[model samples]
Target: AQSVTQLDSQVPVFEEAPVELRCNYSSSVSVYLFWYVQYPNQGLQLLLKYLSGSTLVKSINGFEAEFNKSQTSFHLRKPSVHISDTAEYFCAVRGSGGSNYKLTFGKGTLLTVNP
Candidate 1:
């Protein structure tokens, strides 16, 4: 079984400042990865994902996450953030193969962007 751990529960950053939310997973086998974001009262949205090929995946909203197999991590980063970027981010992992649609998610990290 694989489990994801988000190192920080909350990250506060000033507007236009860079931010990095750390995420780590523990698994002996191959897996698919994803990062989901929730804004305010809205539902969860897929920010980015990594299944195969490239280790780096970017979202349309300037957010990016790099899958590092060696360190078993998929950390999300952004060069600059806005006040609208305040939201809760979740790191999810799903085991490769089978028809399992279940995803193990981390506790989540709340990113609060300030001016």
Candidate 2:
């Protein structure tokens, strides 16, 4: 069984502060890790992914995560968050290879950035 787990369902922070979102997974086989951000009813945008060969991966929007093999985790972090960063974040995983790219999403972590 492959599954993605986001430990926190909500994260609140003031503008300019740093934040870290926790994620973990358990799989009997290899899997691909991904982080997606959703703004309201819009589709999820790929924040970052850890496919292979590299443990550390980063996103264009100043977020990064490290893939730990032993712990089975990929935690997201940002140094200085903004008010514009307020959105719902989801952690997902897909089975390696093949066309079965079905992404199992977490419950979602709502990042509320207050001014």
Candidate 3:
């Protein structure tokens, strides 16, 4: 089983500033990490993921995360932010075996990008 931890419950950043959302996880088995964003009154949308290939993964909206197995961390970062980027961000992990496709998520970080 895997569990995710989001260090910060809330992050406030000014528009056009750089930001990073810290995330850590613990698991006994191989796991896949993902970041999802949830806007007000909307379902979660996949932001980025680290499954295979390069340890570094990025999303279309300029968010990137690096999978550091040693530290058991997968922190999300963006060079710049926008007010429209404000949302609840969740870090999730799922075991990579059997029929267990359940994703364990963190408490979530509410990113408030102010104008």
Clashing pairs in 2: none
Which portions of model 1 show Cα errors greater than 4 Å?
none
List the pairs of residues colliding in candidate 1.
none
- For every model shown, the clashing-pair count is 0, 0, 0
Shift of residue 59 alpha carbon in model 1, Å: 0.5
**Which candidate gets the maximum TM-score versus the true structure?**
3
Provide the global lDDT of candidate 3 against the true structure: 0.95
lDDT of 2: 0.91
lDDT of 2 by residue, 25-84 (tens): 987778999999999889889999989998999988899999999999999999999998
Q: Please give the lDDT score at residue 30 for candidate 3.
A: 88
Query: After superposition, which runs of candidate 2 have C-alpha atoms over 4 Å from their true positions?
Result: none
Q: Report residue 15 deviation for candidate 1 (angstroms).
A: 0.2
Give the candidates in order of TM-score, highest first: 3, 1, 2
TM-score of each: 0.96, 0.94, 0.97
State each model's CA lDDT, in order.
Answer: 0.95, 0.91, 0.95
Reference-based lDDT, residue 88, model 2: 97
